[model samples]
Target chain A: MTAAALPRTTVDRRPPLGGFSLTYLALEIRRVLRNRRSLFFILIMPAVFFLLFGLPQKGQNIDQANSAAAIAYIMISLAVYGAMTASTATGGAVAVERAQGWSRQLRLTPLRPPAYVATKVLSALSLSLLSVLVEFVVGSIGGVRMPAHVWLLAGLGAWLGSLVFAALGLFVGYLAPAENVMQFMGPILALLALFGGLFVPLEVLPHVMRTIAKFTPVYGVGSIARSPLTHDFSWVAVLNVVGWTAFFGLGAALLFRRDTARV
Target chain B: MRTDTLAASETTGTRTPAVLLRGLTKKFGAVTAVNQLDLRIEPGEVVAFLGPNGAGKTTTIDMMLGLARPTQGSVEVYGLAPTEAINQGRIAAVMQTGGLLKDVSVAEIVRMTASFFANTRPVDEVLERAGIADIADRRVAKCSGGQQQRLRFALALLPDPDLMVLDEPTTGMDVEGRRDFWNAIRTDAQAGRTVLFATHYLEEADAYADRIVLIRKGQVVADGTASEVKALAAGRQVRATLPGADEVRLAALPGVDRAEVRGETVLLHTNDSDGVARYLLTQTTARDLEITSRNLEDAFLALTSGEDTDLEGVSR
Candidate 1:
């Protein structure tokens, strides 16, 4: 029999970018949002850290004008930490998906690899935005006395900078075994945060550690987020973020291709 | 561009074969999984790929689905590359297991799959057709093996594909579940969809497939209608107790396919059981003669074990 009789439900195949649909993104985000336990920790921990470390000081001998500027600086650092955790956590769920054969199932579909990667990045970024917003709100309630524009710019900078971590998460998600990925990720991210000066001021760190902090992936994001309030912008920070983004993004793309090819 | 390719496939007003593989080979290190396999399946034909475990059925199916590249040769679906056919939504597959996410509801995953295609059947309609409508709200992890297989079926149907490739679609299902799943598949096949399913169950191939292709060592050993294939391996067995029966002499006898002499008991596989039995009873000191027809399972073993007569001409 000829295929002419088959009900031809054909449509123009979308281009790679066109394959990335809002419907898919919304569904993925909805699934990610269902893990409320992770969301609770990601959102609450930064605020709690801000209350403990940045809340106590009234008039400290810091480089900034007043305790309020120092508090805003600390709040942005913690927000960067929160955003990193949220985005990486979101992106790292790929390890479980891969382990479950969902990635292979997706390879059978019309969805192109580029579209899949795009959806993943956007989904992770969306969660990062949420984490940044939560920190900003907590900072607001805790009497962070920055100009409104600084709060907006700093929050946007932090959320956008977390793209580097999103790429890192995908790379690790594709590389690490699914069962112990999170266990390795938690300590690794905490160390990056500590060394990158998201927890303590870089000026207070020992000379050697301060030098090492500038080279960490978190340093560029933290520096950019705080630059709005402290006027500490530098081309080095931009180069660091771009360089790591390319490194991790290329690694993720390669690993994803390898993973799909074998399965 | 699209119509041009479609028209090209309609040579002499006959469409291209639904699936065609030529000299397809796949190797993993020192192991050869599929060895120069060639097959051509016409549209609307429900063909069962029959083989035992480790017979390279899954490897062939994987190459056909373009999930793995062939080490050599080509795979075409409706005259297009397998991956191209998939991109056009002409083909979809229900893999054996582990395709569904455990935490997602059945209906939700179905909708998500529907979003992957440019044009698709309604998600609810596909779910209903696959017979999983009642359990649409159930989480996949809570569903039984049969329910999850049905869910995979629902996902495959979303693209409204013209060809469905299933790899052991009913592997873990109960007998009744197998019956229901095949019933659904039969209905879909009756709608003029070309289907290629890999199964190790002889009864499943006999009962469901219009044609069966039996494979052994990654090569087609038998390809014919169920009855024809059965006829190829069709015969009777004759057994008799005799002192020092010569297996070579009995195997050379007229109509005997294979003969085995074990101590005093001699077993002979032959089409003319009466002739073999008579000779053993009358011409020798044989006693306690017995004859039995070969069942499909026996036929399966004979065909797959390379013990059957040369069938290269039978399938052609």
Candidate 2:
């Protein structure tokens, strides 16, 4: 065919930035929920942990001088853990999408890059919220005892603290290979949980370990989440969580910029 | 079904070209993928970008679609920037491979992509158009290569784009699949939408494209209608039984480009085979005469293999 045979076409302009359509969010949420393996890792496993550790025992301390009831403390910790797992898991999914060339596909569309990232984060937060809810339910069924105020504070703190992990997930998704993203994230989350006093109370740990735990990002999230249960708010923990959130958020943004600059 | 909408837009009577590249160049470190390419494609023209491996076809297409930033020069689609044109739903592309979520069902993928566009065809209609409605419920990972290609086509159709760019869209498909894919594209093209495709398939360029643009080593070597480009490299062969033929005299004939004596047969290569055949018939006792025109593959090799010829002046 020659160029002379066809009539020329003219440009027709349309509006850009169709302001956060609910359909995009709904579709993303559906995709995340459909992944059963992700659901298990982010929600069910944390619920199981709450059930195992929060059950009231015959001789166990129900309440201590500084801390709230043992069931309530364990419930908050498990819920925070679930939130972190869910957020990071979503980041890992982002890495897999990049590997699959889905980012390239997205670049060709009307959807902007920032909008894509926002959708992923929103869906991740939704899943993390579900994980936290499931853990609370399991804790309730296991005879957790706490005032209504304590329950609300702890739940809100844990859910909000997960933003740090969501940022971390985006960082690792851009940094790590797709197939090994979970492998890279799993041990880090577990170690963070151990050191941050989600698995074992900081008071019971040796003096040196407790000091190091205060420096970990999870330590801030753990301390803040458990403040309602422990009736003690550590300004140091708040500072730590805020600091790490900024660090990870900046790192993820930089990495995403670099990745998109290529291919 | 939405031809009326397309016709209404066309009658707006604006005269912007579908695509225009002026001195477009892209360099990756020391390697240049495309160099000083200038082209203009009018609307509703089905143009084939023909090239060999590493011939800069992909790079040129990448620049055209705004996937890569050019080191020098500019690209405009519908007189708008490439990215702006794409965001406004004026352009869409079907990539060669790996632009899909493997775990999702076909319908889910289509709907997901459709969510990004402000205006879209009905998902079921796109599915039927691409001929993948039967596999709408199946996971993309489970679909065959051809089925996946069709799914990509469905995604491209979501915005009812004015220009569709397909990069090696039929690379992995079998013969029947290639035919079906082109048939779908043809139906869309018949609606007066502009289409640009890059492929190494000679027959595809000859059969599907109204114009052929051949690029080699980061520069366009030839650009014209299929027959015109073919004529640039077209050499015909005339074989006749002329015992004791004077190979020197034959080579020096009016239209003959080369002459060879093969046993009892005298073979003459010429740009004008009919003239040479007439000479052999009327002026000589040439028996068992035959003439054959060179195919597009031969034209391609001839145009691409030589030391960089400045055919940019010849291409219009």
Candidate 3:
């Protein structure tokens, strides 16, 4: 066949910069929401943790504050933890897509690499927001109390803080084997949660552990999320978040560059 | 020879060919998957890339599609870099396997892909055109290999691409499935789409491609039309029944390359079966004579199997 024989119905009409298609995002969001396992991890698991740990101590006092304050503190921490997990898991789904050779398929399309990466980050953020919302609802029903300003600021902080873990998830997704990514990320995120004071207060830990926790990315998110109620905002925690976000963001970018260079 | 077809396509104004490869080479540590190869495929021509396993067909295709960077040399699609052509929706591909998400329904996959294209055919239209409309709701994992392939074709059609590259697109299909798949491809090609397909099936190339490019050990050993490639191998066979046939004398006959005896029949492999047939009829007491030209499979084996021959001379 010659060029003259080509069907006139199909012609070149490509737009400049095939980036962030709403339809594509909607489909991806639908796929993620329909995944029962992802839903359980992102929503149910954190709510369960909040109910088990925070409900019993609902009326107790901590740090010279009402028991409600203590419940609110735990609620915020678990919410941040859930957001972080959801974002990281969403990023890690890249491993499965890579294994399925979907990346190669995308290369053949009009979608640019940067656009693809942006879509993934946005999807992760969406899921992270849902995780935070689920924890917030559970906390509200369980009688956890906080000022309106604190709820707004802390929830926003927690959701924004998850960006670091989302970047880390992308890095790990590109670096690790597809089948073992979740297995590899689960324990690693769990350790970060513990050391970052999501499970227990950093003040209760030994001096060395507390010092080390200050450097972990999640410590910054936790501190920032709880600062409104605790009335303490550490510069070190803020710097930790910024520093680790850059670190993981660069790592993910480099890995993505390398991965695309490979056949 | 169908050289006129290749020439006719090349002379069509100032338009760039769909694909061009120059001194393309790919190496993996100590192993070289593709050597210094050059090829130009004009727009609207259907070319079949044929080779044995590990013959660098996939590697070459990868380089052309921008899935892999060449260790040396360069590739261009429609006068632009491959990635640029792809981003412009000038090119699209349907790979052999592993490109589909098995968990998603066929319609979902098509819709997702369509979203990436700036100008796509209607989703239902593409599905129906690819003959997968009935199976659109089926999960990709539940669909048969042929059905999954049709889905891939649907995805490729989303961009309304001018150049379509397929790497063994019908690898795991039944006979009916293969025929159905080719019919769709043929319809697309006849509409003037440029197609480059790599396949192990010689008959598919013979029946569909206007040009056949045979590669061996990372280099093109033969490039021509199907009949031209077939003629490169030992030409044909001349068989006849002659009681107590003398195999040695038969082998010495003009145009005969080798002679063998089976039961009451004498089989002669020849470069010119016409010469052998004429000689058999006039000089020998032969009965039930038959002359058959070699098929593409024979041509493929003959062109690729021999190790000592300098194939570079035959590559054009």
DockQ: which candidate is best?
3
DockQ of every candidate: 0.43, 0.48, 0.60
Best by TM-score: 2
Worst 10 residues of 1 chain A by lDDT: A58-67
Candidate 2, clashing residue pairs? A1-B210, A1-B211, A2-B210
Better of 1 and 3 by TM-score: 3
- Model 2 interface DockQ: 0.48
Query: True interface contacts reproduced by each model, as a fraction?
Result: 0.49, 0.45, 0.74
Give a tens-digit lDDT track for model 2, residues B128-158.
9999999999999999999999999999988
Q: Name every residue pair that clashes in candidate 3.
A: A5-B191, A5-B192, A6-B191, A6-B192, A7-B191, A60-A67
Cα-based lDDT at residue B307, candidate 3: 69
Give candidate 3's total backbone clashes: 6
Compared with the true structure, the alpha-carbon lDDT of candidate 1 equals 0.83
The positional error of residue A6 in candidate 2, measured at the CA in angstroms, is 10
How accurate locally is residue B225 in candidate 2, as Cα lDDT from 0 to 100? 70
Q: Looking at candidate 3, what is the lDDT of residue B78?
A: 81
Could you give the candidate ranking by TM-score, starting with the highest? Answer: 2, 3, 1
